[model samples]
Target: MQKHTISAIICLAGALVAAAIAGASFLAMRKPDLIVRGPGVTDVKMLSDWFPGLKGTPGDTEVYILKGADDGASMLVLGGTHPNEPAGHIAAIMLIENAQPKSGTLYVIPRANASGFTANDPQEGAPQSFTIQTPNGPRVFRYGSRATNPIHQWPDPNVYIHASSGQTLSGSETRNLNRGYPGRPDGTLTERVCYGIVQLIKKENVTITVDLHEASPEYPVINAIVAHPKAMQLASDMVLGLEMQDIKISLEPSPVNLRGLTHRELGDFTDTLPVLMETANASQGRLRGRTDEALVLTGKDKWYVRAEKLGRLYVPYDEKGHPLEERVGRHVTAISELMNSWNLEHPEKPLEFEGLPGYEDFLTKGIGVFLLPLPAKN
Candidate 1:
């Protein structure tokens, strides 16, 4: 064979191999993570059951219900609103696999934006997934993007406008589930998902709604709870309760001007009191050195430590950075305290549950210790 012909063949072969590897990765991302139902899960339903518009769509997600034996006020817990924030989703997963309601129902949507879980953000250098070592073995969970997968909802406009509030944001935020609140049934895929959630709240008469989240360590809102006006009193009491446990969380009132956020829209549209909690996550921070599974799990970033020393961070940081256990612990502890405060204030409408690990327990035992074992195959 001629020299040039030989070189061309080798180049083509390498390109084909690279394409094959890329295809396999794309396929793997499409596979959903396995989430086992724990003892507390009384029933499992689809979000479409409330709003049929999402039926058979990529936007549909699972809703795990743990109903108490006695009648009382109910609460809805949303995790994975932004899938990149692992603590929120992990906390919701832990609750699904552990909490057993005693007085009122608890509805948990661990993957609030199902479409977002199927892909990673471009150029983010993020891990596709992470694993937790459980007693039975290892359980893998997806580390996904912050917005709806472009594959599902594509081509952003120059500006995105809120359906109800007429507020505008950058086009990229149109796919953000957080900014699609009080959504429209006849809107975009993200908007439809948000509409389904709003429908669920109104239909179920949820007394309270808690949206879990994480923020970059440098973000001022880190380690804080943002509550709607109607929920301010409840959040204040919960903050005090958490402080008593030495958890050290701050309280912020949801900005009325923030049009599409859950704490604002949910409270404005429905009778449900809305609150959102945030934790420090170094893996998602701009100062993070290398984004990988370890960064997501351990959160020990030297860059973040340096940033902290420079007084550029909102949360305290040291060599023992904010580990996944600590972040998840903060979220779980806040939810537990919120429930306690709610019950204390509204004894007749108590929201009670059991089996959730405390903050100290998460720190000592690690997150894997609380994860329930997978069921046996038939």
Candidate 2:
């Protein structure tokens, strides 16, 4: 064979190999992560049950219900609104696997944006999945994109307009589930998912709704709870309760002008008092050093430590760094305190639950202790 022809053939072979690897990764991401139900899960339903428009679509997600025998108020906890924030999802999973309501109903949605888990955000060197060392062995979970998968919703316009309030944001925000609230029934896939959540809150008569999330360590809202105006009193009391436990957290009222957000829209549309909590996550921060599974699990980024010294970060940072346990601990603790505050204020419609691990428990035992082991294959 001619020398140039032989060289071209070799290049083609390399290209084919690269394509195959990429294709395999894409297919693997499409597989959903396993979430074993626990003793507390009394019933399992789909988001479509509340809003049938999402039926037979990827927008639908599981809703785990833990209803107490006694009648009382109901609360909904949302996780995985942004799949990149693992603590939110992990905390929700922990609740599903452990919490048993005593006098009220607890609804947990581990993955609010189901489509987001199918892919990673572009240009971010985030791992597709990360594994935790459990007592039985290891359990893997996806570290997915911040927005809904482009495959489900595409063609971002020049300006993404909020449906109810004429607020405009960057076109990319259209794919953001957090920015698509009080959604239209016939809107895009993300908006449809949002609509379904609203439907669930309204149908279930949920008194309190909490959305779990994480922000970059440098973000001003880190270690804070953003609550709707109606939920301020409840949130204020919860913050104090958390502070008493040595878990410092701030309180921020949901911006009235910020349209389409859960705290703003959910409160305005439904009777549910909406609150959102944020934890500091260095792995998602721009100043992070390495972007890998270790960074996700043990958020010890040297660059963030330097940034903290420069007074560029909101939360205190040191060599110890903020581990996954700490972040998830904050979320779980906040949820428990919020429930306590609500029950105290409205004893007539009290909410109570047990089996949720406390902050000290997480710090000592680690998050893996709360996560249930996977089921054996048939």
Candidate 3:
């Protein structure tokens, strides 16, 4: 056989192998991650249950409901609004699997944008999934895209205009779930998801709505709580409570100009007090050195460390970098504090919950230990 012929055959074989590997990875990511029901979970509902327009679409997601012993005020917690932010997603999962309400209903959406988890962002080098070892065995979760998959919501326009306020933003944000709040029923898939969430809040009469998020270390909002004007007092008191516990979270009022965001639109359109919390994530920062699962979990990047030394980051960074557990700890603890503030302000319609471990629990026992085993199929 000719040498060129042999080279062509070898190249073809390599191409076929690469395609096979890629296909396998795509399938694995598409398979949904499992979340076992804990003592707190009373029932599970779907986003489509509230807004049927999202039915049979990727925008549909699970809603875990935990009703308290006594009928009282309600609260909604959104996690995985941005799938690239693993800490928020993990914290939401932890809440669903651990928290038990004592006085009111606790609603949690672990993957607010379910479509995002089916694909990873291009050129980011993020892992398809990461594993946490529990007592039973190992559990894995997806590390997904920041926006809805283009497969579900395609072809971005040159610019994104908020429907309610006519505010303009980069076209890519059209797929961002965070920017599609109080969404119109006839809008895009992301808007439909937003609509469903709004319906859930309205129908359930949720008193407090917390949108959990994670920002790059360099972003100005790291380690902060952003609240709408109506929710500012609750957030302020929560920040003080967090500070007393040495969590030290800053409070920022939601900007009126940011029309599409939850803090702005949700508060304007609904009675629910809207707030967003952000934790510093080194892996998502532009100054990060390597992009790998280790960076996602450990959050220790030499470049971010050096950037801190140069006074370039918003949050403090050091040799003891922000691990996944620490980031989740901050979110969980802050959430608990927020509930404390709400209960204090609304004594007649109190919101109280227990079984949520705080910062110290995460420090002592790793995140994996808190995760329950997946149920075996019959």
Task: Give one digit per residue, the lDDT tens place, for model 2 in 262-288.
Answer: 999999999999999999888789889
Candidate 1 is scored at a TM of 0.97
**Is 1 or 2 the stronger prediction by lDDT?**
1
Per-residue lDDT tens digits for candidate 1, residues 1-378, read 999999999999999999999989976987887888988899999999999999999999999999999999899999999999999999999999999989899999999999899999998899999999988889899999999999899898789999888899999999999999999999999999999999999999999999999999989998999999999999999999999998898999999888899999999999999999999998889889999999999999999999999999999999998899999999999999999999999999899999999999999999998898887779
Residue pairs in steric clash, candidate 2? none
Q: After superposition, how far is residue 54 of candidate 1 from its true place, in Å?
A: 0.8
Model 3 residue 334 distance off true place after TM-score fit, in angstroms? 1.1
How many clashes would you count in candidate 1? 0
Q: Estimate each model's TM-score.
A: 0.97, 0.97, 0.96
Candidate 1 structure lDDT:
0.94
Give the C-alpha miss distance for residue 134 in model 1, angstroms.
1.1
Write candidate 3's Cα lDDT for 211-285 as tens digits. Answer: 989999999998999999999999999999988988878889898888888898889999999999999888778
lDDT of model number 2: 0.93
Give model 3's clash tally.
Answer: 0
For each candidate in the order shown, give its overall lDDT on alpha carbons. Answer: 0.94, 0.93, 0.91
Itemize residue pairs with steric clashes in candidate 1: none
lDDT of 1 at 206: 97
